[model samples]
Target chain A: MKTFRILGRNIRDSFRGVWRNLSLSLASISCITITLIVVSIAMILSANVNNFTSQIEKDVTIVVFLDQNIEEDDIDSLYYDIDTIQYVESITFKGKDEIAGEMMEASETYDSIMSNWTHEDNPLQDTYLVKVTDIDHIAEVAKEIGYLENVSVVKYGEGMVEELVSIFDMIKNVTIVIVIALILVTAFLIANTIKITIDSRRREIEIMRLVGASNINIKIPFIFEGLVLGVIGSIIPIIITCYGYAALYTRLHGQLFSSIIKLIVPEPFMYNVSLLLLVIGMVVGMVGSLRAVKKYLKI
Target chain B: MDQIRVQGVTHTYKSGVTALYDLDLTVEKGEFVFIIGSTGCGKSTLGKLLYRELKPTKGTILVGGINVGKIPNRKVYKIRRKMGVVFQDYKLLDKLTVYENVAFALEIFGLPKDEIHEKVVKALELVGLKNKLKMYPRELSGGEQQRVAIARAIVNGPKLLICDEPTGNLDPKTSMEVMTVLDEINKLGTTILMVTHDINIVDKMKKRTVLLNAGRVLKDYAEGEYTK
Candidate 1:
């Protein structure tokens, strides 16, 4: 009970300290708010970039067109050969009839041009759609499929898919690095701001010591002050993360520029980001205050 | 019983300047003793050693029967709680009001809120600042600020009070007022060890005066027996 009472008083003193040192508290709070806002933005971008990278990984596939002279048995053998290749996850055969049907349904122009083409006279060739276990090895899998007999053409967007995947990977990596650096910088900034605040109250701390305040008694309020500052500082960024991300998702219609680049759904994503911001704010605030108070308590 | 017992205490600063050399002193409970010396005579060093602020180079100090010199820095607050210290500067926190200033002493001990309030009010009343409880330190006169410092010091009901030049910055009249307050506190059974350069106050009050010169006790005078 006595410990609880002391804790309660320390908490009150921290709140009072914040209220009394309004300018210093504001400086620290604003420092956290601005840094957290930037961190949230970096986190959101990084998360979306990762999502897009995975989506691309799933969507990319190898398309191997067979020669027009190939027989049905030859096609089945070719399919088996392709299936036996390393990293080949799955293979699906699409005959010329199915290909013509899909092209015709895609547009009236293709349908008019191909409506009279009989199956025997069809210019379209049968194709095998291939998926690989690893997107990075898609090129190797495609090359192996191209060497197969009766395979006339193998296409998987050639250079474009690799470049796009690499770019997405780089984007994800850069944003991650940036997010981490920003969090570290934010913690440093909060530590300095709280240090200035504590420096201004060195006399008060000395007086507390002279009056026989235990180290814990002297430290509790300042640490609590930091906690309060951190929590308060995170409020604006959290609001922005929760409502801003949701609004951005709604405004962009859940994707950016086109469907190929997608944004994460805001429901749980924004909540998770907001929770992270809150935790960072709180932990940084407390640790920063603790460090500053420790220096002065040595007296 | 002796409230303070210093035996062969010697203090050397980090710069190798020996401030006190083999000094021995004792003060019984409820006694008032004045420690007077020249500017560099190590009077302040003795006060600091007694409070465990400055560890002695060679000796032991017992305040309230605890071996204070050997107490670790972290646990020094336990010894400090049994004594109060007043500085010449009257180190009252400018941000806290008079009431809060005194109450801060009890608050550190985690006393009950009601008891803290009662003690704070009583201490302030004794210092004649109960009516000025809400006023800030800057709003008070120098002597009043020193009284607030006194109130804060004695709020813990410390058996011994170590005052280092409590009136060094005050005018003659104000110093006497502050001295009167100290006298009243000492009369109420708190042993006071005051270090001062005010010969007039010392000669007039005529308490037991221990005179020092160059880190050595020059004279130990009884009541009404000290001279310039």
Candidate 2:
């Protein structure tokens, strides 16, 4: 019962402290707001980049062209050899006639040019479409398949896939670093603002000590006040993260620039980001207040 | 019973200046004693030591039978809660009203709200500031502020009340008004150890007086016998 009363008093005092030091409290809140906004943007960017990378990994496939004169028995042996390599997820073989038929269906020009070509005169090569388990090891898998008997050429957009993946990886890493740095900066900024508030109330703290207030009693209100400021500071960022991301996802039609580079769906993603913003605000606020209290207040 | 017992108490500041040299003193419960001396005579230092604000470099001091010097800094509030202290500057919280200032003392202890309200009102009434409960410290005069400080000090019903020049910032007339409140409280059975350099109050109160010179007890006077 007594503990509850003390907690109740501390909570009440925390609110009163914020109101009494409105300008200082607002300074702290605004600091948290601006930094958390940046942090939310970084988180969204990182999440979307990860989404785009995974989509690319899922869609990319290696195309292995067989020698035009290879015998059916040799083609079957080459397909079995390619399947034995590690990281080879699945492979589908397309006969030359089937390839020619696909080309004819794709365009009127191809249909007119290929209508007169019989199977004997057709020059298109039979190909194997290979998918790999890991995109990072796609090049190695393609090389192993190229070494197979009767294989003429191997292609999986070689250099372009590697470069795109590397760039996406860099973007994800930078965004993470940016998010962490912003949280630290917000904590430091709140600490200084709370320090000034504590400095202004030095005499009040002295009187409290003289009047028999324990150190815990003196510290709890200030810490709670910091927590309150942080939570308030995060409100705007959370709102922006939830609504802005959903709105952007809608405006961009679920993709950026093209359908190949897709955005994360808004459903649970925005809610998760909002939760993250709130937690960051709360933890940063408490840490900042604790630092100010420990360093500045003698008690 | 002795409310405060100091034996061979010596206090040396961190700057190497010795404030008190082997001082010994005692005040019985329900007794009112005045500690008077010239400036730099360590009268305020003694008051601070009694309240455990400054630990003696060498010696034992007991307040309400607790070894105050042995209590660690974190547990200092346990000893502080058993006694009250009034400062020369009044030290009323600027943000709190007279009623809230008095209520703050009880609030720190987590007393029930109704009990706090009752005690705050009674404490204010005793100090003759019941009508000014809503006034902030800045709105009050010197005497009223001091009375509010007194009310806060005694609100917890501490056995010992240490006043370190409660009237240092007041005029003579206001000083007497504040002194009257202390006298009334002392008569009601609270032990008071007041540190003051006010010659006029010392000459008039005629209570038990202890005079200090160079941090040593120069003279001790019984009630109705204190002289300049």
| Window of ten residues with lowest summed lDDT in model 1 chain B | B69-78
Measured by TM-score, how close is model 2 to the native structure?
Answer: 0.91
Residue ranges of candidate 2 with Cα displaced over 4 Å = A65-101, A112-134, A145-153, A296-299
Q: Which ranges in model 1 have alpha carbons more than 4 Å from their true place?
A: A64-97, A107-134, A140-155
The candidate scoring highest on lDDT is 1
lDDT of 2 by residue, A234-295 (tens): 99999999899989999999999998888999989999999988988888777777776676
lDDT of 2 at B157: 93
How many clashes show up per model?
Answer: 0, 0
Candidate 2: the clashing residue pairs are none
Give per-residue CA lDDT, model 1, range A179-272, as digits (tens): 9999999999999998998889999888888888888888889988999999999999999999899999999999999988889999899999
Q: How would you encode candidate 1's per-residue C-alpha lDDT over B34-109 as one tens digit per residue?
A: 9999899999999999888889899888888899988888888888888999999999888889999899888877
Report the lDDT of model 1 for residue A28: 95
